[model samples]
Target: MNSTTIITDTHTHLYSEEFAEDRNEMIQRAINAGVSRFFIPAIDSATTQAMYNLEQDFPENIFLMIGLHPTHVKENFEEELNHVTKELARRKFYGIGEIGIDLYWDKTTLDIQKAAFKTQIQLAKHYKLPIVIHCRDAFDEVFEVLESEKSTDLFGIFHCFSGTYEQALQAISYNMKLGIGGVVTFKNGKIDQFLKQIDLCHIVLETDSPYLAPVPFRGKRNESSYIVNVVAKLAEIYGLSEMEISAATTQNSKDVFGI
Candidate 1:
């Protein structure tokens, strides 16, 4: 790994229980592999303290975002949104994120999910912060909200983007950067097929760690260091060097998060 190359995992849950046993060691491994910047996304109020703890432990490397994840939107969603509102009012966050529609898990909450996403987008605009969106099996639904919320202040990453080439362009239309991750390295991960068609500027790197581990590590726990594998895959996809991929995507992340 090139120590000079600074890889950024724009979307990762480092506070996840999966890393409880050796979180420090895991983060050190990622740093040693050149993944020095980590953007942590919130799941809900339940994970707020843990995210704060991660920031306290690694202040320089960890950047936090507060939002209620779509899947976590339920009966008490308004209360969760109130928590996000209060947190934003209380302190600074890099962005308002990990918020969007996830029909893959539940369709009954679509109305509430849309309401939460729109409300958070408003909050992001209010704070002049970018948003990190999570869209799973709900591109149409997600884009519907984005279309309505579209504006100069409406911008952020489409976290773990697994959309088609057209969808990629559509996301870019909304001023969103595509967040490529382990899925690109999957044998059936179709993003690799048309990724080269999209410019490197519209792309950023992520792991969505402890969830979508890349090949060789697939079906296993994912750590930030494994982002080097994603770098290698993007290098192959774009016919560029791994260092070039790292530099470009890291820059793209900074552009979105303003960090």
Candidate 2:
């Protein structure tokens, strides 16, 4: 119910080493720019502590999620999942996230990735928390697992959504909100052209910071403050003012994360 110019970065790696030098200043800049809520995703066990630290540092502004990212899933994934499970039981996380299939990196681990993805989806349902998914060159693979697990209880964000309109509808049918990020502002970022056809309610803003910086800051290390670029792009795409896009998408994020 906060009446500020709410802009929520539904996905960001504040725990990334790239921001170690000036994380606090960068966060303050974003806050001053009205980018209030930040949702942090877990990459692996290695980043859990940093994620927790970010929350402690900005408990009211930053929210945390727990999961093993696709690229981080390895042969001994059972141990990694055990870590996720233990953490979920030990603390309250906003979501079970940054989880899904990624064939763009290593296809050899597809089976293990599918298993881990399925396991996390189940975990998310068990805890009644939304999920944040990461998909890359494996849309069909990700969709197949989601189809098998689809249910009224299954809902979350399709982080870094770069799929077609048909795929977007399919993702929505499965109760997933598209996590639009800096890529939406890229010149060749095709999704921007057709995003207007999709409902804004099914969209959420993200920076995926320390990576995928929007135009003017594109190709540079991204920070949460750069979300202003994303909001501007969305305003152009939707033919609405920046405040309109910010308010609508921030509400969409709250609906998903229950903030």
Candidate 3:
């Protein structure tokens, strides 16, 4: 790996209000820092337009994914799924994503969340694109859904992956890559200790920006440029050069998203 090679932020949220004041400037900073690729995950209907605008503003830097987020899943999930399907039919999306079961925030909608997740998985299969998952305190539930839908066509990333080594292996078995982000750099973020045992080929860099900012920037709003810190952390943990980690994860992201 060389400094000249570009690093990809496999998962990020540039559409969030956190970047409203200087989204373009933040993106330019990221590009200047050698972090060029941006994979944007959809939250719900409310973000579609903003996502589209971001893509139009920086077509080459940003790629998009379409799907309903689990936290937003409710009795009206059918309508949300309809929006996702319509978007997929209307144009192309890099992947079907930010989709999965999240029980951490709300457990009341578990059943509906599962249904929406499964439906999105089916959609990913139908479109022949990878799926980007958002799992939270429901790895078993997520694995159950993947188990039911397991096939060569089923694959994607476990975004913001903070699961145990065994769970990470389980996710890989389903053809999914682990989306490593800010948490890996936390003091108590246990993943760093065992991550070296995992191959870099199965990893991808992400920030989940506007949410989990990496250390030194922790508790503050995150942005794409902050992904450089994530790359540096992985380099330290894996005992490899920053360029090595960047190249390997960027390649892994390309493999998963077919970019």
Error of 3 at 23 (Å): 1.0
Task: Record all residue pairs in model 2 with backbone atoms less than 3 Å apart, i.e. clashing.
Answer: none
Question: Residue 96 in model 1: shift from native, Å?
Answer: 0.9
Which candidate leads in lDDT?
1
Candidate 3 pairs with clashing backbones: none
Query: For candidate 3, lDDT tens digit of each residue in 1-259?
Result: 3549789998888999988899899999988888889999999999999999999999988999999999999888999999999999999899998999999999999999999999999999999999999999999999999999999999899999998999999999999999999999899989998999999999999999988999989999998888889988999989998888888998898898888
Per-residue lDDT of 123-171 in model 1, one digit per residue for the tens? 9999999999999999999999999999999999999999999999999
Q: TM-score of predicted model 3?
A: 0.98
Q: Whole-model lDDT, candidate 2?
A: 0.93
lDDT of 1: 0.95
Model 2 weakest lDDT span, ten residues long:
1-10
Per candidate, the number of residue pairs that clash is 0, 0, 0
How well does candidate 3 score on lDDT at residue 196?
Answer: 92
Task: Rank all candidate structures by their lDDT, best first, as comma-separated numbers.
Answer: 1, 2, 3
lDDT of each: 0.95, 0.93, 0.92
The positional error of residue 67 in candidate 3, measured at the CA in angstroms, is: 0.3
Q: How does candidate 2 fare on TM-score?
A: 0.98
